[model samples]
Target: MTAYRDSGAPPAADTAGTRRPTVVVITDLIVLAKHLRLLDAAERRGVTPLFVFGPETPADELARHRRDPRHPLSRLADEGLRHVADTSLETLLRAVAPWLRERPVRAVLNVGEVFVEAAGVLAQTLGLPGPGAHAARVCRNKPLQRLAAPALAPRWTLLDPARTTAAGIRDAFSAFPAVLKPASRMSSSGVRAVAGPDDIPPLLPDYGLEELLLLEERIAGREFSVETLVRDGAVLWAGITAKDTNESGTSFFTETGHTSPAPDLTPAQEKLLLDANTEFLRAVRFGTGMSHAEFRLTAEDRVVLMEAAARPPGDAITRLWRLATGMDLDAALLDLALGTEPPTAPPRRRARQVYLDHPRGHLTDVTAEDVPVHWVAEQGRWPDLPPLAENAPARGHAVLVSRHRGDLLGELADSQGRSVSVVLDAPLGTGIDAAAHDATGRVTIHTAAPSPAATTEEPVG
Candidate 1:
């Protein structure tokens, strides 16, 4: 059962004497659950947000959301939620036509991965602030990103799965120990390392015939991502985040953890990374909103671009920044979407998020019941931890579990495989090593052996 019905009529809008300017938010259900705080900020700022869900919510899941009052669809019932048949620019423009007529749209914000292009096109068409169509196109397609900023990108070759044979792929690219990735997927969905020529054919069938793939030179270095807030083609604020991934001894490159204001960089390394990120953002012509650009610092002190995304990063990165610095990134992101100046504050703390992965089995329990936690999406029985003091030397932590009992767990092959996450807040001048260790010790994920007939599969949500 899906949560939405395909009604031709427009969603209910403000019937009050004065209508607030609407910020057309485009996203899917999964991402929507993670962005309730942004909605809260929007309301506080006196902005009306019209949500356009680009994907369907399964009936059972919708029922689950209805059961939890914290879900966005339920909590923001007054603000309209529209289910669009497709995410093309035309479809989105038509779906929001009625609301566009009723209230002025201040911005068209892309909140989910798939809606970036549509949101960009809509925002540009309406002359609003957003990652314009060019930035959206380059950000969405990895090949385009490589083309747009060749200097920042690693050496790579593009292959059309429909036309290129395994031999041709082998001939065109010989950077053994390379990474084969789909040009437009997110969360390392179709990203894997290839040892040599023999690895090409075996993986070809895994991708779509029409999909374009990249054979990129495997960059050996410390991986990091730069999160930047841009306006009018200039960077306002940028922070470096150190990344931990399972790719060290494995073929899959699933990110396991992230720490904000990367604590390991020297003065020179920090300048190089921030400079490279600025160059990449400029190359893509990113107009406004947040840009999460990833890079690798090679052993020889070179920065290589992994990829970039034109949306708030997944895995609570924005939240980590907010907790680490006094800045409210969610509120700032809303302000960017509304074409206003966001409040700024200096960093007074450090924060890290560590994803908990359990052995392959049926998830039986996640032990954090006694510890006070503030759930990011749905609430549990634990008492909520109060917000950390802004000006004091304070430490805080929160636990979030995305899986329930009896769900099957799998290898940490990608971002989706990790179920539980721990976030730690530390006072300024604290190192990431200590905070990360504390966070990892805060939660334990226990799993039980699956039935004899059970097959290896993705975890049930």
Candidate 2:
């Protein structure tokens, strides 16, 4: 990764003096692909875009994009990329103010969780329509969500990891099973459940949670995320996604896959979820843009809001939405930021996405064969899969589509059950979950024995 220093000098003025509207994008390195989509969308709408990237951006990834002909970054304008050496709020504002003054900024946008606050601050500073810094802070901090919307949120308590000992947490959470997570983080990073005091300390070092944390009573039931587009403080479009995760022995909540248009939810159930989300968003004062809110449905059919972010959903959820509903959420988000109406067409198809995970070891070979259903995309090496933990990365992805809901669900179950049948020859014992989707429509993992050809050889770097 190349390090960037703060260039105190101001950006060169647009010599052509054309007053082309521009969108200021504040984001981090990990979400470059999403950034590329934003850039392409802006250009398609005849708007200029200036990307202010955090210093942590990977130089190698940028170089790869510049080399790939099909990548949008390959055609990025000369002044498209700028670096902010310091990501602090004050420093970011200082660096971005001058740039916005030079161009006619339509809106400030961000997809990554880390930069949402910056985008909100920029919009508020310039008096543009946005979620605002207060809303962004409420969305980013998990405990704040509970405090802001207590009636809709799960029971939670804030903890100072630097001061609170494990014994204190145990006493406070003795009545019920609880979840411990960082106050502000994404991708399930530093998120785990705690049965008692004994399980707390061991997991702290792994997450580096020596700061602020949120310990909430774990809501038991089906998990789902409601994706919404807000305009004038009202929800214009709402899409529900059913989530599947490794439910065997893993303490972490890493998603194994997701299906869109959640076939299992009845119209009434879906309405309840959406209504709760809308109320929560209102309580948080989310005035504009897109939101991805997670919730749990108890056996009594009650909805409990977990958390919500002031941005579009990641992990190809937008792609699934596009495939199912003919709604290009990426484009919609850009349009929303630019103060335009987005598409609100009903869904036409069902879509699903499954991620590949294996044991913790280097891989020698991998293959996908006899896949009964056609896949949208799949590519990755077995040796490169991240370990099963918080923020575990997906090794490969397979997207499936169907015209009917029942057929799509059946296809998803079959594909998930047989997904592990793919040959993954690795030295360590592979954790293959043969029955990933159960009859209840929940995503669970059932580990099976390793194949006979498996060897104990060391992995290659």
Clashing pairs in 1: 1-59
For candidate 1, which ten residues in a row score worst on lDDT? 376-385
Q: Per-residue CA lDDT of candidate 1, range 36-58, in tens? A: 66677878978877778765434
Each model's C-alpha lDDT? 0.76, 0.63
What local lDDT does model 1 show for residue 252? 97
Cand. 2 Cα-lDDT: 0.63
**Which candidate tops lDDT?**
1
The deviation in Å at residue 395 for candidate 1 is: 4.0
Clashing pairs in 2: none
Best by TM-score: 1
